[model samples]
Target: MSDRRLTPELLLGAYAAGVFPMAETRDASEIFWVDPERRGILPLDGFRMSRSLARRMRSGRFRATLDRSFPQVLDGCADRDETWINGTIRDLMLDLHALGPAHSFEVWEGEKLAGGMYGIALGGAFFGESMFSRVTDGSKMVLAAALDHLRRCGFTLFDTQFLTPHLASLGGVEITRAAYRARLARALADRASIDAIAMDGDLQAVVQRMTHTS
Candidate 1:
């Protein structure tokens, strides 16, 4: 096992090696390493946009942005009860964002923060840490937009770490640790143009490409 120093660079290094850190609770001071037996990932070309979800996205009811309000997004994800985002982890997120590699996809309805997500990216790999939603389908919208951005940015592996019903609804799947590490190594060996994502953050365009990709 690594030293688990919890610095921004150390965290990135850990992610590159296919492990991540978490805490038992929001108030916990210590962080622990997590390398699950089965890793959860959403196939870049297999995101689902059901009729109802499609309808909401097409309606243009919300807007999305990247690297905007990162702290808020992190806070939102940690707002729930029994969160793993302790103060140390939160500081690491802030530090990582400042040093680059960490990013957020924020969704807003008018001036209100509706939903958002944050994660880390390296080469062609992206580690989706957490997400939150204040309104219905908000997190899904953020995810759809994120996938499009990732695809455009040339990212190939979207690691979710764990599977949940919410993630399953969006085509998240579990793979053996060995298979996941294989994919991770491949992704780390490749290069992806992060600049291709730009700052536009358009949802309709994302939805349009989703059907064509898979």
Candidate 2:
């Protein structure tokens, strides 16, 4: 299917089928589907919290929020030198967000957006598309809080799509495509909502809970 034919329903259906669209560059007008042989996923119960990340989490230097400034978060994630989030993808995501399952987790330094991540949430699985950081450990902070939020909200699978060394250090692991499909199937059959709980609680308490759990 062509990128021009891609709609919010089609995008969500693609995610349900374990395939996603990508572009050659941010300016690319066309997009293609990608279904990797290996999938990167962060096990909800297996996130690694190092001393520094834990300390940073408890420092109260940043606050975490959900679905706030999603458009800004999208801009942040695509602000890099090279990105696969082209205009078509960005527009589609915006439409998806309006239709509801898509969400963004944001980390803030006072009124500034330090970092954030966005993804498509279907049933019990959250397909993390991209994240960006404007400050040190900003993306990491968002990831930590996103994981905690997902866990508390009853999500079962956190699909990072591809594992990077950064995510590997934070407990992301690669699994066979078959294994990933199995997990995805189960998750799709289950039920969860990223918006089920609010992020209005204490940041330090989130860190403490993650520290004890991890």
Candidate 3:
């Protein structure tokens, strides 16, 4: 289908049906649907924080916030050598953010944007789209904060779409499409509020909660 013509309603419907929209390249105007054979997911109760990362979080060098810079997070994710986020996708995401279908979690080191993550949320399922980091432990801090937020909001499924070494280290795992669909079904069936829980942009508090729950 044409990416330029993909509306927020169509994209939401697609996600509800267990597929997602994507562009082939940064310059591509046509968007395509994708349902990979393998899916990447993070266990809500298994998000791992290494000892060193825990120390960093305890050090309070960074702060985390949610939906603070939705557009900036999307732009940062696309600011790379190779990206599937084209102009159409970027605009759609921004629209989704405004409509509350998309949300972002950002980590700031003082006044600088250290790192952040953004994604789409439906029911109890959160589809992680992308993340970016500009300083050490920046991305990790965002991920931890996001997971904590998701858990507090009663979300059950954290869909990464694809697994990477970076995600795997933090409890991301690959699952077959069939298994993924089962989880997705359960997640969609349940009701959860992505914004029900409030975060204070406190990195240490986030870490303490994650450690206590995990």
Per-residue CA lDDT of candidate 3, range 1-214, in tens?
2355778988899888789878888998777889989999999888899888889888877888889899999999999999989888898898899998999999988888999899999999999999999988888889998988888899999999999999999999999999999999999998999878787678788778888888
Q: Write the per-residue lDDT of candidate 1 for residues 1-214, one digit (tens) a residue.
A: 2224667888888999899999888877698899999999999888988978878877787888998899999999999977999888888898889988888999888889899999998999989999999999999999998888888788899999999988998899999999999999999987885567485556676777887776
Model 3 weakest 10-residue run by lDDT: 1-10
- lDDT for 171 in candidate 1 is 95
Q: Cα lDDT for residue 118, model 3?
A: 94
Q: Write the per-residue lDDT of candidate 2 for residues 105-197, one digit (tens) a residue.
A: 999988999889999999999999999998888888888889899999889999999999999999999999999999999998878988788
> How many Å off is the CA of 131 in candidate 1?
0.2
lDDT of each: 0.88, 0.89, 0.89
For candidate 1, report its TM-score.
0.95
Q: Candidate 1 at residue 80, lDDT?
A: 95
lDDT value, residue 178 of candidate 3: 97
User: Which candidate do you rate higher for TM-score, 1 or 3?
Assistant: 3
